[model samples]
Target: MSGTSEGPTPATDLIQPNVTHSDATPCPGTEQIAVPAAGQTAAAAPSAPSRGGPDAPLPATGGTTPMAESAPAPAGFTGMDQQPSAAPRRPPAEPPFRSAFSAAPLAMAVVDRDGLVVSANDTFGALFGGGPEEFTGQVAADLVDLTSDPRIRQAYQQVLDGRRARLRCARRLKHPDGHPLWVQITVAPLAPESPNVLLSVADISARRELQDRLRHVQNHDPVTRLPNRTLFFERLSAALEAESYESGGSGRVGLCYLDLDGFKAVNDTLGHRVGDRLLAAVADRLTRCANEAGHGRTSVPLVARLGGDEFALLVEGSTGTEQLAELAESVLTALQAPFEISGRQLSVSASIGVVERQAAGTSATALMQAADTTLYWAKADGKARWTLFDPERNAHRMTRQALVSSLRTAVDRGEFTLEYQPLVGMDDGRLRGVEALVRWRHPRFGTLTPNRFIALAEEDGSIVPLGRWILATACRQARRWQLDHPDEPPIFVSVNVAVRQVWDSDLVADVAGVLAETGLAPHLLQLELTESAVMGSAGRPLQSLRALSDMGVRIAIDDFGTGYSNLAYLSRLPVSALKLDGSFVRGFQHEENTGENAAGQGEEHDGAAGRPSPADEVIVEAMVQLAHRLGLTVTAECVETCDQASRLRRIGCDTGQGWLYSRPVPPDRISELLGSRC
Candidate 1:
């Protein structure tokens, strides 16, 4: 018999009594180990030698040792304990697996093939709020709370079937104390041939909470806790994409861009802190409105703050523009109520620009741009209102912008040219003067009249330079015509002056310079200002007009009677003529049957019912008398027929300018007419 060490080995003490070791008969040179059957006591086995130590041969059968004499009678002994002479006497001590398992920080459990927890570590018991004994015999799925997830069961089956070596997942576990535990779970086979699996769990609730916070911060605004512009755009893009796919190009999407009117007053009077609180309150109301708008519907509108006082709402799968209009009206109405901020009630209104369109061809950028433009329209049309996007109006604006952008270079490029409209004498039927009309021969759009781009030019202050160019060009042409026709009576050239040009530029100096450069007498160059513009002139503007008149420049009030006629001031002005507005001249075409022929060859009517109505004739006669009293000439404009000319001549009109004699023609045409008249 071989002697075994009497000292208790660390590996032997760690092994529980329930754990069984395999029993195998020893060969000639090998040692064999046996485990006791259930309820049976067995003799102690020999302890293994220390690892990496000198080897000692096992004792052979019948070899005497210190413990051989004390060996109990072997019961059901399959083989005698022996040691080989050539082999090592003892094996190295087994590793401290039991101690490591018991001391591990991770919650660990051994589960059988039947999904039962065979054993659990103290950490596992503490994590689940119980002792190891309580966890033992419990179903592994029940303890881990993974039975609800089918993937976990599949993963376990795959690992157990030798398909995968290990499986990992995060799961929520139920604690005995009713608290929830988020844990990362890893499963692996205990051994190659064993029907048991080892599960390692780590509590990760803090990590999950941190991730959730990060996601929330990324998707929500810190101030309002609402979705910010970033998230709003993302959702808008997604909605557009989904609509494109689902509707196959017919689905509609709408956006309402809101800007608080008088929000700046709040910030200026109060402070930014109060403004921030007010914005928060506004956001709350907007969110509630959005929810109410989307209540009982499948799709909910997304409302977001685009920064500052600008907020936008996106409506996906919108039915039509009517729906968007309703939403916009609701937004404006909702903001009508006063907001209470820091014990102060503040009132605010919003301008909403609504744009609804098919989602197929529309892009996020285009939609946003349109919405912004519509918002501008709302503000421009008057705040506290909503404006629907109109393509025609937008095109007009875009064309205006294009014209403005091209105006600066149009002068240098010679895109502008002058057309001359002969101003004929109403009585003599001969050309007296010509009005210089500026025309823009655009590269893209052809033959644009002044009405198309003049307002745009005036707004951007580009009219100053353009007006200078027109003045210089028209004077040069008139001077040439005068030089060419020295024997003929001098024909004055009338040029229209814009209000901004008169107010913003040095009109006296520009006219003086142009007249000197072109060698045209100021008397032959007439500057026509609209009645409204001239009537409103005062201070420096009135002084400038008087100065120009003193310089031998002919100052005429175009479109007379269309504005407030300050006849008292008009009498004092150095105005050369009053060009009656076309509206007044059109009255001459209305022939009443008081037995008057087209040639006015009937009963002589003085301010009576005739081709020119009695009232209109009276007004014209009175205006002509007033002008004659002031020593100013009267010119009737928009004369298209001989009857109108006859009536104007009968009314003592000195000049007639319209298509009847000839439409506005070029300088050469005027020179021809002048030569003919001469």
Candidate 2:
């Protein structure tokens, strides 16, 4: 649309070219962009981004041109006037300063001392939905849509007043779409001698979202979306402060640390995928319980995912250990049911460790240390239980942890030694056999018992090596005893086998090798199996026991009566001898009773109902006769007293072993006992 030129024409019409293009050429609003007035050329100013408006005139970049490497000022306006008068000025070829400023990358603006946007860049113009001229005399707060939060005006004013150099702030800017674009606004003095403040803004919407994700990962567990260790520690420390340091505060903080029991079995039997899913389900249930406990199912505690199958709960304002126990019970009850995952009904159990403290000594580190100790105790007591922290028990737990840490290298260091308790024959009173028991001369802990380390050895799979050493050492000693006492009968060596030792390695071969290496006959091995263990045999223990027994190994059921009540089932096993549990022998006495008190009216059965009454010579005699008929030699255990030894010998019992004979004297001690007696 063309119009005849008026004498004093409008400034925009002077640069608005009327040249038309064919369909092949770049169309209007595309490549043929309108230019600015002569005064508008090179009039770009640093933008007041925080103020949100266009500025006029970029401060000259030194004396050098902006395009020059490392230079500042644009090439001294050289090419501007070089255009010929007859060159038919087509908007100066490149875009005018006004149009370029309207599309500048940064939301830049120039604001006066009155806090009004005099001019701004294209990005600033787009940000405020106003032209540079229209933005003149407009206050930054007015241009930024600060109607919701006008306090943003003060943030920019501080920069202008020299109280702040660069004001960094966040605000919601009204976008062209009528929505808010979160922008990180940066406002500062534009030029050294200039009266305006330059505001710079960045659309930080995406960066803010990224920051939120990073914060989530930092503060919460990736698997459970619950507060993680770091965040939990922070919250716990705060809770403790509230309980102890806060004014008028008298409550305590309770912590529960739970680890899923048998979870590794699930992970190995099922896959890790199922294990992860099970963990998630566990987290959900735990979160629910933590919310309910003291807070009555409405208040949520600081539930944290402390990595792996472990989770922790922080209960603030807890009163005492009773509350701690209740929290632990809640956790145990919550995990008592089955979790269905990966198409399997997985029953998982957790060991909870509860620690509560009213004072400020409850540091995050201290609480975690105590909780961890308690958790271990719970697991040790048997899975699916909770253990409260006790200072005394913590000492033992710490000692055990120290021992476990050092146990791996204990064997190589020769810290372990075997002591043999000779299994003496009841009839002949001769050293017929020896049971090997291991002891640890721990460097610091000193003389550790089997109860202290054998379980640890089993856990770390060190039992395989340690057990092998035990067998070989015991066999070698047995062979030495036989050689040393050539005139004496061959003494058998009984060694207890760990289930882990049997399952993880070739136990039969290891046993055979130990016997062969020590030159001890297989029958002289007497590998004892408990009733529970012998009966618990499946494919491996069964095959292994059978193979060894086929090779002349006399299998004896050790610790017999202590395990199972069923004596009839023993006949089905290959057990040749029954090692009567020592507990049964503790009752042996001189006086004998046939249960008839004067009249034998089935006299009200005193405590002794099943077995013969106290001092029952007849009951002892009957047990021996029954065992002999079954071809099962009865070995009476723990003949601790002379009366006991004499009484057992008179009762027709086959053999016995206990402190009464010698109190499990070592080899040299055995040599001493043997030289003094039969």
The whole-model lDDT of each prediction reads 0.81, 0.72
Q: Candidate 1's residue-wise lDDT over 313-416, tens digit each?
A: 99999889988888888888898889989999999999999999988898999999999999999999999999999999999888888898998889899999
Clash count, candidate 2: 28
Q: What local lDDT score does residue 425 receive in model 1, on the 0 to 100 scale?
A: 85
Q: Which ten residues in a row have the lowest lDDT in candidate 2?
A: 1-10
Clashes of 1: 5
Model 1 C-alpha RMSD to native: 9.2
399-419 per-residue lDDT for model 2 (tens digits) = 878988988898999999988
Give each model a TM-score. Answer: 0.72, 0.59
Off by over 4 Å in 2: 1-253, 256-313, 316-353, 357-408, 427-430, 458-460, 487-490, 499-508, 536-550, 569-572, 589-620, 630-632
The collision pairs in model 1 are 56-89, 58-83, 59-83, 420-665, 421-664
